[model samples]
Target: MPSEQPDGRGVPSPSQVDVVVGGIKGMLLDGTLGPGQRLPVEADLARALGVSRGPLREGVRALSHLGVLETRQGAGTYVTALDPALLLAPVSFLAELQQPASPALHEVRRLLETEAAALAARHAGPQALAAVQEALDAVAGPGAVDPQVFVEADVRFHRALAQASGNPVLAALVQAFAGPAVRARSRAAVGDEGALARTVQEHRAVLEAVRAGDPDRARRRMGAHLPAVEDPLAGAGEDPDAGPS
Candidate 1:
């Protein structure tokens, strides 16, 4: 069969699925395919890759899941936009799958955010600063807000902070690391009476530092703020010292 890779042992050397995947990836790397470009017909691609339809389809599906391909009904499969944010979505999912109290994820978040805050302090314009303020206002708004609502605003604030850094790559990295942390923070907020208030206070501090155009202060404030968010989740069903399980 075209899908079988014959070895000396008379066994398949590699799965057809992998062959298809690797072939497409090679096409991508060599510029035979490109972002937003339509791929050849499925049959054509299968023949070109020396694989059968089944394995080619499976490989396409897997690449689609990785945000590397897009299938449009009636048109055919095409390369995705391949934006960094879109490509990093799977990394976000992987981060979300980690333990709720994972310190490693928090460490990554801290590293990305601290640098983002520093950049934001240097680069943020009035509109970006306003966006940050709006996010902060949503979280610290009057009356009682739902924990989920607070979490959403909290995420928006940090994302805005990242965007203000004027670096798309840094923003995407921050977003990828923040997804799971936000979920964990939401859960922690539900149980911890003072979590929301403390979050507002911390966000305010970071915003103030960013607004003042003090890069060092902004970096320090963000570094401090992220760990504070993790404090409530420290002992939640996992050993804080142990790595992600």
Candidate 2:
């Protein structure tokens, strides 16, 4: 049975998990809980939130999985560093499961990647640019013909580009879409002799624009590149037996 307070209110009750979760979230939003700060002792926190220990622990576990909290052995739980990439890990998994890519997801990727390319051009330093170039070169190397190797390199190139944008959130967003994007490209590349070559060329063009520090050119190149990769899957979501246009 739930515990009751004197005022006819339920103490440590009424959706205990939600109450606990909301209490923690409220604390976070109000600056009471900052990144890397250790949470109050469990018993103390539970009492403060008017929830039982079970629900409080469960809520904490949930937040930990979401990358909003971190638990250390014998050190107690603390807020995570709040890195965008860490926070978006679950989002990446969800994006990957939306097989073949949906129009909305593609649109999101296009917008984010286009901006990332421009930012990369303007802000990417020598080291970051070199990483992008390395990924690009890997795609055009001897093993480029291998589908797995080619796709891996392709994903890496985009990832590097996103990182070079100097926005961790943007980079994480790009990575979230990468899995489905790779699958779409991989499906299109199968038995298509020109597909791999075209992809390498397109990536080269984008890289060249970024290397030249031309933001407009980089954005345009990326805008053009995504469609080329996605076009082959145009009707992928339509009737399975429908004839190709």
Candidate 3:
């Protein structure tokens, strides 16, 4: 094992990790490293960064958590593809930690999804539209009679809508919001007053608008569908997560 410097004794400090992090980030900025590039071995990287192995590992772990890097068993660490959805995926954790944030999450989701629906109406091709319709049918079909099945189907519908929007960043943002939406839907109390039926109808309304190529109506319908989710989440205010499916 390599020995730490005199000042680098005991547990590693933020400064030590910062050295490693800053070094790698500088390399990335300068194009010395890039998406899908493999990192050098630990000893060499530590030597290059002028940091101890402990801090280098911590820095790498931190970057991995942020989806900036990935470590494969025996294959070593490499930069991720840096896709928008992969980077934004960690936002899902926010709802789990602070339950009160669920409404805010839904609001952000609503804004993104409404615009996405409008864009989808404008840009969706036959295949994209078909994909969305298939997702919608899954939500309204037999298996969705089960609550958990309904939640999964509902998420797929939203994901398909986002994909049809032709905006990758917007789609990624919408995908990240799925965590809160699923958490809220699973905990919701559905009724014979037609909660599930109402949801399916709302989805149909959005689909109708999209099929008609009416951007404004698609936006309006999506806007309407999403607010229903917000109220239930607000009412549950900081309730325990039934656990994100």
Candidate 4:
């Protein structure tokens, strides 16, 4: 580690760290490092960048969290293969944690998912369609899987459906919102067997619409599937008394 300067002046500069991380990330973007190639030694890196060890390690840790670098205990750190989706997981977490004060998120999900399901109906290859079916099957049982399990499977279903739409952006967008929202909704719906049954039925309807290649039906079914949960901000909201199924 480089010596810490109390006044925080000079020595291992923060801006210098930024520059080094940016350079390395650029190399990652350009495929210069190539996946699995061992990074140069820490001493080698400091020498190459003309910086002290402190900032160099900090930059490496930051990149590691970004999923652009992998560190092995005895071996060496290396550039990751840089899968775009893997790198975006933190982005998804941030998106999910954004303001939930309004039902705007439900609206967003409704808009994206309607279009995604419709496109999936038309463009889904056989394999993608099968993946959707598998997810549907996993969640088909009468009882909701543990809230966490159900949320995860629900994400897989939506993500697979979004992928079937043939749009990576759509998939990523859906992945971002669905995880947090599913966790919330599943928790709200747990032990509410009626709601669980209704959810399953709605999913089945969406699946059928997709299977029939009827985009209009798919879109409508998706829209109908959005439940009006207890949103105090938006009216008294739909009565909890209403049976879910």
Candidate 5:
């Protein structure tokens, strides 16, 4: 494996193996590494990242766990299908890390979800519309202030709406970002006051625009709804305590 120690020249550490792996992972996340594209030969990658073959292999294995790449006999490694569900496996792993600090996943989630919400408004079908209404009803009906139940409904609501966008990959991305604490913190931030009430209204706006088949309106409405959730994260510097729950 590549040494984790820094080189005498004070180069960016001798952890070239991790560097290679992280480089490849970053490429995948940024869409530079697409599914079905073969990776360069081990020697080539090693030279590029200034690492040896041993650490390179370890890096590949780590990304494989995230479903980001695959190796074939004699054919070498290739990027896996750029499916959202596949991409999200690492999210469960990341979730464990969140309990220790404020989760940064919400930022990623907000990006995907806001996009999904906009798309759902444009592409929603009768069934999709029904799902949105059901979720909204769950929030509005009696005994709605229960945070846990409301949180569950909220997840279902956003997820269902994302799926309605007719994009499975996008839906998966949304789910990965929408971690439990992020949801809970959002609820807590808004509390049982007008914030919750505003959420219902925003969701309704998204649904109504979708029902009307107005993609632009849907997108705008969805975009409008995100500020309230995002504001706190902006002030909190990404890991600020969600405060007790």
Candidate 6:
């Protein structure tokens, strides 16, 4: 291992791991490394980055977790496709940690989903529209209405709406925000027939606007739906006194 030293100009360098990370990132941005391209062999890359193998390996691992890189068995590390959905994967896991629900999460959904509904109205194709309809049907389906059915259908309805928005990143964001609030959402919906009925009616309105391809109406319907949806979560247990963080 080379001794960690100043750049010989009196300025201390960043940590070796950071050096490796930055070096790889620079290469990526400058087109030296590209999607699906395997990185140079470890020994060569280590020398080129002025870092030891340990830092290089750690950097690769970090990048992999970020969806910036992938390791192939017996092949080597390579850059990933850099898809928005892939890169945003961590947001879903982090959102899960919110648990019982956070008012802030719901607020974010309100904002994003209103715009997403508008976008869906503008861009949804037949197949996408059908998927949304299926989710809604599942919600308002048959004789026995399971509370869990509402929760799952609710999640799917929003997800399908987002996907129909024709923005992968926006869809991913909406899905992430929705996941963490499920527990509280279900808590309030279960055994509440009125809540169930209200939810079905609201979803139908949003779907109607979206199906009609009216962006403005879709946006308004979604804006209206989000608040009604979150009404239960507040009482379900996310600290109403604490306010939205």
lDDT of 2 by residue, 98-217 (tens): 776777788898899999999999999999999999998886875437778777888899999999999999999999987678667767787777777777877888899999999888
Runs in model 2 lying further than 4 Å from the true structure: 1-14, 142-144, 233-245
| TM-score (all chains, Cα) for each model | 0.81, 0.85, 0.79, 0.72, 0.57, 0.85
| Local accuracy of candidate 6 as per-residue lDDT tens digits, 43-103 | 9999999988998999899899899999999999999989887898898888777765577
Off by over 4 Å in 5: 1-64, 68-83, 91-110, 180-184, 189-191, 231-245
Per-model clash counts, in order, read: 0, 0, 0, 0, 0, 0
Cα lDDT of all candidates, in order? 0.84, 0.83, 0.78, 0.73, 0.70, 0.80
lDDT of 1 by residue, 1-245 (tens): 23667799887687889988899999999999999999999889999999999989999999998899999999999999888898888788888788764878888888899999999999999999999999999968778888778888988999999999999889999998987787677777878777777778778878888899999888877776676557764433332223322
Q: Let me know the TM-score candidate 2 reaches against the reference structure.
A: 0.85
Cα lDDT tens digits, model 3, 1-245, are 12343444666445778787778889889999999999999999999999889989999998898898999999999999988888887765665565654557777887889999999999999999998898778767653377766677778888898999999989988887765675576457354335676668778888888889999888877776776675543322221123211
Candidate 6, residue 125: Cα displacement in angstroms equals: 0.9
Q: Which ranges in model 4 have alpha carbons more than 4 Å from their true place?
A: 1-14, 95-104, 139-153, 167-169, 191-193, 227-245
Write out the backbone clash pairs for model 3.
none
Span of 10 residues, lowest total lDDT, candidate 3: 236-245
Instruction: Give the better candidate number (5 or 6) by lDDT.
Output: 6
Error of 3 at 225 (Å): 1.2
* Top model number, lDDT: 1
Candidate order, TM-score descending: 6, 2, 1, 3, 4, 5
